[model samples]
Target: MLAGAPSSHMSSSVSTSQGIFPTSRIGSGESPNSGASSFTQPIADMNENDETDLLSISWNQDYGCFAAGTSHGFRIYNCEPCKETFRRDLKSGGFKIVEMLFRCNILALVGAVANSHYPPNKVLIWDDHQSRCIGEFTFRSDVRGVKLRRDRIVVVLEHKIYVYNFTDLKLLHQIETLANPRGLCCLSHHSNTFVLACPGLHKGHVRVEHFGLNVTKLINAHDSQIACFTLTLDGLLLATASVKGTLIRIFNTMDGSRLQEVRRGVDRAEINSIALSPNVQWLAASSDRGTVHVFSLRVRVSGEDSLTQPNAFQGPALFHQNSSSSLDPLISPNTGANPNSSLSFMRGVLPKYFSSEWSFAQFHLPEYTHFIVAFGSQNSVIIVGMDGSFYRCSFDQVHGGEVVQQEYVRFLKFENRPK
Candidate 1:
């Protein structure tokens, strides 16, 4: 959770949010050297022309900061005080994607923004301390996603994945994929080791490559098609969701063992994103149905074949603890009380909705918006939308009741985004 998050209260009405940076772009007046701000000072009478279309959002929990790509530039904000720490108006047409290198000043940018310093088809590595583009790499096709790890750069293209040496920008290896439109690829690094996972040669299968392409583990995770998948930081485990969207399966990356499964709901819905917490204790999922769910997980880390007992909260931890005693069922259909109650399942199912996983802590959004979910610094849930609205809310382990969410930040006012 962000340090300064206000004490929990039922604040249902989201208030208007003013811009963090003025209209003329950061260089015009809001330079980093600007004097300290006072709370008594009212925002410099706002303006609509000051705000730009927010194209992408990236947050770093380590430093409690996040970055946003706008129509004309990119801006970084500190999470605690919600202050803008860095801003650059490339004057490039626009930035569609901005990938921050954790808390460091290093970042990668690619998108509609095409300029002498940056281009739409290329990823420019920027060092904020220097306030200049340091290194960049271009792709044959439009670049979709860029993942920067300790020593390598992973770039995702429509039908291909590229890995590059971070220091010299040398092309290390490339892997072919099966028409991944969103450019989904995840890299997990730990203890000086790395593993990369993306869609395999087949539709619903997943391929895991350890370090280079020397050793790869292929797991037939689902039947329908992969919606999304995320790996534990150490790359020892992977969680996958298929287009069926109802059930989520966790796999051991080393040997492709199906450890455990969690149910979102029996209703068929589009799964947006799935995140595994640092300790592998919590799993969060978001869907097109306008809800986010967090599930408590239990993993036996003693042995490689140790079973994972998904501790789905129905009433309390005491009741679900018994599920771990037996290894008979790897995936249980009994994700009770938490989500997709039998009644809704009968409806979204017979009516042909995809099954979904129940989040231990579920939050809602306005309908028909594209959103991505992640865990914040303090087990707080962060959900961001493609329309430029983001939220931060923590789950109450005590009540296990309705979740109250506070609006954290807004990049685009409802009226400002182009229709």
Candidate 2:
């Protein structure tokens, strides 16, 4: 039996000082960093009876549901009810699921064996409610990621991204990349630019392009593996978490400059997941130590537009300047005429830490938070823990519109997005 009831709370406090940069600091800020924050109570929790590792998860925005892919198959949960709505209903294939995603109402599940030596490849699409396999695709090589675009379904494989037309599943494009790629993120909001991440033995690099043809920016960002990452909806901010250490770095998505580095989970444990709120005002990270941390972020919008140097926060500052001599031409060149150099101008575009005070709320889970995601347009958070537990919690947001009123207004407006 689980020892604790497994509850989660939101506790936050914002404090501003002249600024002290601890080598092991978990969070940072700029001048005039007036912190503000709020918290919420744990709403509900559900458990899946799995002993193996839980791998991937996808949130069904329209249906108010979420699904988690585990070592064997996959488990489905209803975020509204905070319970396991279904278990391993459609995953009958022999391979283990590595990734899962939901577009509209359709669910996609992908997985591969690590040491099997065989090209780890399997794809299955299941009906959400019926929990039945509606479609399946098996490839020769392992699949890295599955990205759903309004116009296409992108499948990331070894060094290549296969783009299939969403309407017909016909191959439309194939993007080639550096060998042994690790991360993939779609930059749809910025003129079809897709961000590709690949970390080497000693450093990390990110590329921005579309159809795998155009190379916009390539910069080395990290030292070890990038554990979890996300880009803001506007493609202005990019957040990356490290697996080698408990550090989260916020970068200017435009040029890949370090904006703020958060060290909160470094000593606690490895962070397994990170979520960027829809408004880009908050960030949530799930740690291996059975805790989910919520941070408030308020971007310092500077009025200056000069390009001589990268724009920085308007408040107290803490900079991570590696020996200026060791910087790479990709990050800092000798001539300074590098177009990529000024890319740091996007630094102050996204909020990193809350302007108000906030504290980390600990959730003693039946297990650790394996994967977590926050819902769009809602103040809801969903966490899937290692002990097969799935928890849902809602926070108090005064700025969030009233649900009853917004729904009525939306229903009455009858305005279509754009035909």
lDDT winner among the candidates? 1
| lDDT agreement with native, every candidate | 0.63, 0.44
Candidate 1 per-residue lDDT over residues 314-391, each given as its tens digit = 011112224322222232233323444455556655543234335566787876777777766556777777776668
| Predicted structure 2: clash tally | 23
TM-score of each: 0.73, 0.55
User: What ranges in model 1 sit over 4 Å off?
Assistant: 1-49, 61-63, 113-117, 302-357, 414-419
TM-score, prediction 1 = 0.73
Q: Stretches of candidate 2 above 4 Å error?
A: 1-56, 60-64, 70-75, 83-95, 98-105, 111-120, 125-138, 170-202, 210-215, 300-369, 375-378, 394-419
Candidate 1, lDDT over the whole model: 0.63
